[model samples]
Target: MGERTRLKRILRGLERRYGKIEPPPKRKGLPLIVATILSQNTTDLTAIRAYEALLERFPPARRSRPRRNLPRDSDGRIDKIKIRMVHVADARGEPNWRAIEKAPLSVVRNCLRVCGLAETKTRALRSLLKALRKETGGYSLERFLAGCDTDQALDKLSALPGIGVKTAAVTLAEGFGADLCPVDTHVHRVSGRLGVVSPSGGRNGTFRELRKILPPGTAHAFHHLFLSHGRAVCTARRPKCDSCPIRPDCERRGLEEV
Candidate 1:
């Protein structure tokens, strides 16, 4: 069969096996953004822990004036106040750059330390915030998103001191629900294993290859699906091939049988 046909078959199989792909929980601004930054070169659970620890140290609302039900967005989306506490408790919040930028570097670094690689991520985040402020006149998430197109936004973000293709893509895909794939280690590895791309190159190559095959508007969903499946089944070490729904269609490019 042709590559296109094979890819289609594999995607269909994945859909059948995984069912509907669920969008990751929409996080509040600061915590989720911080979590994404901490997620670099770290496990998700560790990132979550670091995120929680940071929030605990810098709770959104003090004990005296506990956060109450803030007004939701016009679309009925819950306001930041209501969800900020949940993010503090569990480290699952929206992407709030304003809150994160206002946080002290020491506090940010300490929070990130819980996940390991604290020093590196802390520097990166500091640089990112500084760059944002310099470029945008202020680090306003809504304003930034409104100012740039997809490519422009990605370029601007990647130009930041610590941000790279993956980080920039994450900001677009997760922060704005853009139709782009943030090819992290898991997505890169799993895509190669499933024969979506060659195994010889790195994540960027895999992203380029997949972009040619995937539909324009489907990249966001595709990224989430591949990521979720990679975590659940197509793990880096000893992927559960038997349990994988797409196994029958996976070419198993560079991977061994489970």
Candidate 2:
């Protein structure tokens, strides 16, 4: 079969196996961004715990305590005071960016240590948060990503102290659902096994080649789907080839042998 035909088969089989792609849980922007950073070289469960712990320690609104039942105005309407009260109260007990910003590096590092990549990721997280505060005037993650294209976003994120291509792509894919593929170790390995790209090339080549082959708007979903499939079925050590939905196409391509 032609290379293009094989790839089309692979994509269709993947869709059959995984069903339609769903957006990951919608989380507040900063925490989601932090969690994506922390997920580097770690398991999802571990990353989630670390993210929750960090948020517990440093909620997004730390400047003032939340108030309840403010007095009404002469019109008997709960005015701006009530609005602020509601906003604060709703935000009460959530992660505060101010607290995170003010936290000692050691504390921040320790908090992230639980997620894995303690040494490297801590520095990245701290640097990113610091830059966010300095550059954006606050922890406005939406503002930070605003007006940036996928490539621009990737460049901006990878320019941070410890963030790299994989981390940036993952963050953008997960945090903003941007249309970019994140070729991590798993995606790289699995893509090679499926003969989508040559095994001789490294992750960068695989990313570039796959980016060329896949349809433009679906790259983000395809990235997540590939990662999830890698974790769930196409594992590194021993892929469940027999049970895989794409086994026929893979076998035809000698992917299992590879």
Candidate 3:
């Protein structure tokens, strides 16, 4: 079978094994960006706790709501939505990035201590928000979502401090639902073992290869399901290959001894 066809079959098998996977609820750009940064070098549970801590540390500034909800159309006519007007920071529960930017680095780092790599991640987050403000005149990546194509978006995000292709790809996939696959440790391992992509160039290389052939509309589910499969079965050490759902498709690269 062609590579793409084989990948589709594998994806289907994964779906069957895990039951249909879905992306997390969409997060606003800045919060998602911060959360992705926290997710590095940690489990999702830990990352979530650290995210919550960060929010609690730098809670949103209270803003009075409009006296009445704005009608969708006072005249009962729908109007075209303007992408520029979408400021994700204005969303309820979003932390005050400006507050974060002005706070001491140690304070922010303490909030992320639970997730590990607190100093590094804290530095990255502060730098990223500051850079966003300078570059976009605000603290949101919504412009990338509204304006850039997948590749362009990836380039822009990857250039940010404390962000690599993995984090950038994730922000795009999870936050904006862009059609790009990110190669985290699980994804890199599973894809290589499944013979979907050669593992020569590490995560970024695997990500590039996967982008070329991952079936369209499958990026989000592919990422989550692959992550689940890797963690549960195709783990870094002593993977449960014998009963793995996609065993038929696996090349078992680097697993001969196991």
> Which candidate number maximizes lDDT?
3
Candidate 3 lDDT over 1-258, as tens digits, reads 588888888999999987786654565777767877887887765676687687788877884342322123355532111101111222324677898999998898889999999988988898888888887888877854467887888888788778888888878887787887788898898888888889988999999888888988888788878887877778788888778888878888337426
Q: Write the per-residue lDDT of candidate 2 for residues 138-197, one digit (tens) a residue.
A: 877778879999889889888889888877776676567777678988788778877778
**Ranking of candidates on TM-score, top first:** 3, 2, 1
Off by over 4 Å in 2: 1-4, 23-28, 62-94, 251-258
In model 2, where is the ten-residue run with the lowest total lDDT? 81-90
Worst 10 residues of 3 by lDDT: 79-88
Better of 1 and 2 by lDDT: 2
The numbered model that scores best in TM-score is: 3
Score every model by TM-score: 0.76, 0.78, 0.82
Candidate 1 scores a C-alpha RMSD against the true structure in Å of 7.2
Q: Which regions of candidate 1 are displaced past 4 Å?
A: 22-32, 61-104, 253-255
lDDT by residue (tens digit), candidate 1, 1-258: 487677666667767765665454553332334456777776665766776675566555433332324335577864321222223323233334556677778777877787887878888777766665766687555465576787888787677665677877776666576678789887898888887789687988887777777766677767766876777788788888877877866888336653
**Candidate 1 residue-wise lDDT at 125:** 74
Rate residue 25 of model 3 by lDDT.
Answer: 59
